[model samples]
Target chain A: MKKISTPYHHGNLRQALLEIAVKLIRERGADALTIREVARRAGVTHTAPYRHFKDKASLLAAVAREGFEMMVKETKDQFSRTTQDALARLKVCGIAYIEFAIHNPARYRVMFGTGRPHGKNSALRKASEASFGLLLECIKECQKEGTVRPGEPMEMALAAWSIVHGFSMLFIDNQIREKGLFAADRESMMDVVVDHLYAGFKPN
Target chain B: MKKISTPYHHGNLRQALLEIAVKLIRERGADALTIREVARRAGVTHTAPYRHFKDKASLLAAVAREGFEMMVKETKDQFSRTTQDALARLKVCGIAYIEFAIHNPARYRVMFGTGRPHGKNSALRKASEASFGLLLECIKECQKEGTVRPGEPMEMALAAWSIVHGFSMLFIDNQIREKGLFAADRESMMDVVVDHLYAGFKPN
Candidate 1:
């Protein structure tokens, strides 16, 4: 095969490869992606992708890392813009997390999918930790402000994460809309769900 | 290829096919499953599987339906055996759900995986509804018994479902233990998580 070296060789080849790999994942499900195919799409030599991604799993790890970083960025953006109290602000972050999943379903799957990079990738693992860490920090603030009940911050954060993550998965799978389970306006439904998360339904 | 006649032909062929399909799915990921392969493994002619399942999607649909049915059975088993109240009963069901996911991760994945059977399968859809219906029924009872705060039963049930489902996904994906997010004993951890789910930490 004739080698076609494009401007990507001169300009940030690693970033270019990740961009194309993400595009491929979005277009086709992750199951069919290959490093050779990513290189072909990037207009580089078949071997060029190897310079950045040793194999398909590493390439996917890079995509997952990018996904976590993007999620943290979106959550932080919401935190900065919102003026609500700690618990309420945490709700805003949850909304941001769900919105991120809604806008990027394919990438969202890769971030949490079973095939995600395991113990081998520290960068990917750190990115994953950072995303969850944002929620942990918010819960700590909520407890400190007396808005949330006192408990281990990590456990409470996991509880909060469960609701948003579950809702996002169900929504992306078309389970929510197709089943007509919660037909109320989407934003209001999330608000109500968050309220449930804040105040569990146990009668006072 | 010569067709091998087996007792499954005279017995319950459909059940046999489903069993074989489940085994294949467990052994190999769902992506590689095919009707012909299943039939071949079942000691039947390639076209034999077509009699029960029209295509690969249909075969997958049957698998998903079985998963839902099995889940309902497991939940009901706990209900009959436990003496807990409505809200507590629901927690038992939730624990059963998480346990099912932990033990049968592959089947659990297929029950909720995106590529699962869609509009074409009514049996599959109803089976899926029945599983959620159990949770909704529990929430309705919880409301009646004054254990849960009054709200739209579906919405409350969904909140309950989201937490359990999200936890299951995270656990099966190795996110929970791998990160040491919940280091306590498994059952006690679930109990605390369920409590957080029941009584959200909002200060009175």
Candidate 2:
């Protein structure tokens, strides 16, 4: 395979380092990542990464931020392909969230795993908030259509998020596989899970 | 502080090593664990841990098994204290699960984290199944009492597990804290989250 190389310009170098870091995380595990290793993989001088990342944690935060952005885009794309019915759109978005994690298990782990940067203004935190904002918007739409029960939108959003996030974590962590649950038809199992969640949102 | 030391007898050594392993994971992280380190911490010879555990992974499996056993006990204790109303008992058990994770975050992480042993007869796997069995029993009782909607018990149980597990992961992983989603009172927030799940299980 031909080695992928990036030009040494400041902008290209930073983006190149981030790309290499993600690739390394995917190929190996997050523990395999390092500035020197990413720089080597990017075919840049060892010190080149220093200009872009202050430390390993900072690099990880960047990777997590990228993961969040990709998740938001994928979920929105999936939701957009569905009908205008808020409930249907919510279901599409929820499944998309799980699919994103299942397809990109390593990135998903880093996105939610411990040790990434955390603060009000941190890049990763902001990216996560943006992704969650998409879910909140979907819930609001459901409420507007009188499909979902009216309540504090944040609480409802968190309830929706917990179920999907929990399912994804169990799937990614192999808990679902280990227990021999949903082995034959995962898509159907997802429908059952989503349907249960949708039932909770209906006005009682 | 007095260091807790164990006798070097073969039987005591194995149990001692497991306890020390849990302690090390709590203080540092799972990656910090090793047979040699656990043995040293247990005040045993370097080769002693090898007698019980063939490798680090095996040691981790033992730790995870212990975590599951403790979780089962904790959930059962909590359930026994609640009224016979299946729904009420289920709520108590669910809260116990989250409380167990919060109080023993490292052990909880190891219990569900990737790369541990997984097989039909593996000790860790059996322990996990047993823990999940308790939840299934609660759901069954709910169905018998005509509280929860009648359906496939397994599906309802999985749905319930997903929500609580997701909430615990989010709380433990600091996702809730980072997003500033629930700052004032987490206990009440948990009630809201669990209430949404309970609503789903009600008959239409």
Which candidate gets the maximum TM-score versus the true structure?
Answer: 2
Every candidate's DockQ is 0.47, 0.52
Clashes of each: 2, 0
Candidate 2 true-interface contact recovery: 0.58
Q: Write the per-residue lDDT of candidate 1 for residues A1-204, one digit (tens) a residue.
A: 745554444467888888887787678766557788878877778888778877777888888899999999988888888877887778877899888988887788778774332676889889988988898888888778877767777787778888888888887777777778657987887777777887852333
Sorted into a CAPRI-style docking class, model 1 comes out as acceptable
lDDT by residue for model 1 (B37-134), tens: 87787778888877877877677778888998999999899999988788778788789988888788777877877432266578988988888889
**lDDT per residue (tens digit) for residues B1-204 in model 2:** 643464436557778788888898888876667777877777778987888888676777788888899999988887778756988888887888888988988888777764323654377878888988898998999899999999888887788889888888888778887767765587888888888988888975
Clashes of 1: 2
Q: After superposition, how far is residue B108 of candidate 2 from its true place, in Å?
A: 1.1
**Runs in model 2 lying further than 4 Å from the true structure:** A1-6, A9-14, A28-40, A43-51, A115-117, B1-6, B9-11, B32-40, B43-48, B115-121
Residues forming the 10-long window of minimal summed lDDT in candidate 2 chain A: A2-11
RMSD of each: 4.8, 4.8
**Pairs with steric clashes in candidate 2:** none
Q: Each candidate: fraction of true contacts kept? A: 0.50, 0.58
Error of 1 at B18 (Å): 3.8
On the 0 to 100 scale, the lDDT of residue A27 in model 1 is 82
